[model samples]
Target: MALLNQTQVTPASFILNGIPGLEDMHIWISIPFCSMYVVAVAGNCGLLYLICFEDSLHRSMYYFLAMLSLTDLVMCTSTIPKTLCIFWFQLKEISFKECLVQLFFIHTFTAMESGVLMLMALDRYVAICYPLRYATILTNPVIVKAGLATFLRAVFLIIPLVFLTKRLPYCRGNIIHHTYCDQLSVAKLSCGNIKANIIYGLIAAFLIGGFDILCIAISYTMILRAVINLSSADARQKAFSTCTAHISAIVFSYSPAFFCFFFNRFGSHVIPPSCHIIVANLYLLLPPTMNPIVYGVKTKQIRDCVLRILSGIKNTKSHSV
Candidate 1:
């Protein structure tokens, strides 16, 4: 048995379940998933193209938005492609190293998104609370630096995850109960001591998540305080309008995130594994699908640019016809 166990050794591939206990509805569920992924990719690409070319949108806010869109794009591309494959093609076997890479990017980009949201919150707070110094405080160079710094932070924070996960010996079954490779999901498959992995994972998650939530809360609270003090109703309304898109974005991105984090970690006792898996997929997939819709529609500048681009394309088609 020892020799058999030694031969089994470290796994090369893992089996991923696509919405367990709901296999009957996999085809039905895939439709919406495919639609959301399509819209998110198109919308984010359009947003990035617009921001790159449009001189008017070359400001700090839009730049951060571009970062957000890019992060969202990476976020979805990491999981959804494989997820669709599982649902549509039944290709559920993922190589172990590839799984670690996926796990790294997913968690890393998630942290990147969180960091970008914090920067966005800071941008809005400054724009609203202190208009004059906004330009001075968040210059173009500064914005670029912030973006790079966020990327670096995500990379540094997630590098440890790769090592920690790889250190574990997976003598147990190589089956993960979720579609995508997550740190927890993959770590749970190891047969050796995983207490350190679990502890480090929780600490990292809360540090990034809790810290950002606190900072965003502070920034928004201050923003609300400032908005409330404005004398004219129109000015106040206009100021508040700028924040609504961001507020919606924050809600769209984080609500499900925290839910899945807590429920997946804690609710295992009460909830069915299938339900937990579904919610995990929902939170992982929701932000990328919803962010572009929220920003592209709610923000006037991006919306107008998108509309103008569409109209130009239409006019060109007409002329060619």
Candidate 2:
């Protein structure tokens, strides 16, 4: 038994069970997943292009938005393509090292996303509450520093996860019961004690989710107070309208994520595994897909830019005809 344990410690690879009871539907499932992946990629890339090129979008708000879009792009890309491969080609094998790599990207980008959202909230808070000093507050250097801080926070926080997972002895058979490599799911496969993994994972999740959510809430609260005090009705309306996209983004990003997290940790026994897995995929895919749409619809600047580009293309086609 001891020799068997020693030999099995290093698994050549782990087989990903795409979705436990939905094996037959994997092909069908890939269709929508593929469609969302395409939309997320195109939309985020469009935002990035517009932000980089459009002189009008060179504001602190758009700068933060560009960061958010970039984060969304990387977060979804890290998981969705491999998920599609698992669903479509039946290519579900992932090496231990590759799994850890995926785990790092997924978690790191998630933390980064949360950080970006917090920054967006802060931007709005400052813009609304301290209109006079908004320019001075979020200067180019400050925005750059904030972005760098978020990136570093994500990197430092997630690098340990890789090491913690690496040190584990995977004596159990290498079958991950999900589409992609989830930290908890992979940690659970280890024969060695995983209390450290669980504790650290919970801590990391709280540090990212709890801290960000709290800050966002506080920022919005102050923004709300400031808006209410404005003398003109139009001013109040404008203030609230500016936040519509950010609020939608917050809902799209955090709601499913927190649900999936708690469900995976606490309600796994009661909830269906397939449901949990589906929500987990959504937690990754939905935000990237919806965020761009939300911003495009609600943000006048981005919407106008998109419209201008479309008009240009239309005119070019008409001239060609």
* Top of the candidates by lDDT: 2
lDDT of 2 by residue, 1-321 (tens): 877766599787999989999999998988999999999999999999999999999999999999999999999999998999898788999988899899999999999999999999999999999989999999999999999999999999899988999899997889999998999899888989999988898888888889999999999999999999999999899989999999999999999988888897899889999999999999999999999899999999999998999999999999999
| Candidate 1 residue spans exceeding 4 A from truth | 1-7, 318-321
Q: How far out, in Å, is residue 174 in model 1?
A: 0.9
TM-score of 1: 0.95
lDDT of 1 by residue, 1-321 (tens): 877676356787899988878887888988988898898899889888989999889899999999999999999899999999999999999998899899988999999999999999999999999999999999999999999998998898888988999888887788888889988888787878888888888888887888888999999999999999999999999998998888888887888787778876788788887777766776767777788788877889888887888999999999999
- TM-score on alpha carbons, each prediction: 0.95, 0.97
Cα lDDT, all candidates: 0.87, 0.93
The model with the greatest TM-score is 2
Colliding residue pairs in candidate 2: none
lDDT of 2 at 239: 88
Kindly give the stretch of ten consecutive residues in candidate 1 with the minimal lDDT sum.
3-12
